[model samples]
Target chain A: MVKSYVEYTFKNSLPPNATVLLAAPTLPIQAEGGIPGNKGIWAGILSEMTEFALLFGVYFIARAHFPQAFKEGPLRLSLFAGTFNTVLMISGSYFVANAVLAIRQNRPRASVRWLILVLIAACGYLLTKYFEFRWNVGQGITGKTGIFFTVYYYLTFTHMVHVLWGIMGLLWVIARTRMGAYTPAEHEGMEAFASYWHATDLIWLVIFPLLYLLR
Target chain B: MKAMTHKRTIGLLWLLLVALTLGGAFLGETAAPGLAVTVIVSLTMAFKGRMVIDHFMELKTANRTIRSLMRAYFYVVPLVTVLVYLFGDRLARLTTL
Candidate 1:
């Protein structure tokens, strides 16, 4: 009776050809194209880049109009802090990339370690930015100080806000990772987070030169 | 083995990025405000952005459409920036509407 029930279920669940297809290796939806993580994340990244591009347009326009202010602005700012933050950002991005690689190799423990390093580097960035902001405020360099300062503050602060969000996402990914939520085949969450962080880092690469090294 | 190779490649890329950042800083400190420094700095920006997009974001393996879009973004941004730097006055006047 039990064998009859099992056979009945199997025959009803899958057709004969369907059984063979089910046993075959799965294929991707599209033969030649795919986005890392997913399409949604890529769309978000494109939107983020678009927004920054508009901001950059405003910056270049202002700089073209007031070259002297842009020239003299970086002199007063702390080049050390800017450089330090740039290093921290790129280092963090490197670690995050390593984390992604580690997970893809099914080394969740190694991935977690890399992620921890990323968080450490991110903390370093926050600390450096905090001191830089304090120094700026101490020297009366606020958004209203000048056009250059306004652009500087606007760009860097918006970036910091994004980094803050990335940090939160990192913590969540770490927790999920620790719980074995992701495997070698299914780790889109972690990859998406890494993509976001890398995009932020790329923005800073442009900002570092435009704000601190363009004299 | 493949994983090790990837890690090594990422390490090398990171070192190169660091070198470029410091070199750009040095150039900014010493070079006069002119086309040379502007071009060098702009090129560095483009290179760094490309590395991040290709290696870090893994866009190298993405579909043609997504890859082209991202590549265009990195290229156009730096190009426009350099152009605006060199021809700011004319650009401003042209867009004065």
Candidate 2:
């Protein structure tokens, strides 16, 4: 049944070395529905969301407890770093999404270009973040500084870890894409990585205002 | 023609995201923090999140369960931020332990 579906979707001639990227363990193909990348990736996304939701809960409690500290924290932090990171994240997300779009149009080379742009943006994010953390420590604003700084550091650090994971996932996707491991008909891996990266970007959108913009 | 339309849509989304980020930053730095600032910031935050989820993640056409879960996260988080701003004292007293 699944084979017939695949055949019908791909027109019966599977691309050479086409990867069998199933949308779910029970669902072997995406032609049956729109599952984005795969069930596994969605599972990962859900788990990531849960972890961040807990962190966000912690953030709110701390903010409620120390409203003064929360109010004053952003004034001390570098708005430049915050805004720069936000732009990079948004641009990287846009690039990765374009990569997905490109591949869907069967433009593998264009997809690679878009993926490369995402890598550049990701590298920019890591560099700016490193400097931002250094600036914070240099200013004597550690986790123990106050409730607000504590929450800020914890949330940003947790987010940074996820971004690192995203970069690694992106690298793998880029390599696979260059090897022609993805096709318009079977590019679930690329979509999966793009989805994860976009999710990471989404979290940053929330974090930016809370930490830097809300004041 | 279809690819061009997709490209245009992505370009527009990216522009909007960038504009909102800069606009929010300007407001945060220049405007006094108050009810108005908080409301604007929270709404923009939610809007930015939705753009990514719907267009960038291409989850607009995704499975109902996954899409709703993601959308709910975006909505609830921003709404909670507004509530925290409005009732910080009450929340603090309630959560004191």
Q: What is the lDDT of residue A59 in candidate 2?
A: 84
- Candidate 1 chain A lowest-lDDT run of ten: A25-34
TM-score of chain A of each: 0.84, 0.84
Each candidate's interface RMSD (Å, one decimal) is: 4.1, 4.7
What lDDT, from 0 to 1, does candidate 1 have? Answer: 0.86
TM-score of each: 0.88, 0.89
In lDDT terms, which candidate is top?
2
Clashing pairs in 2: none
Query: Fnat of the models, one by one?
Result: 0.65, 0.72
Flag regions of model 1 displaced more than 4 Å: A1-32
Error of 2 at B37 (Å): 0.4
**Runs in model 2 lying further than 4 Å from the true structure:** A1-33
Tens-digit lDDT track of model 2 for A29-118: 223338888889989999989998999988888889888888899998999999999999999999988898788777889999999999
CAPRI tier for the interface of model 2:
acceptable
Per-model CA lDDT versus the true structure: 0.86, 0.87
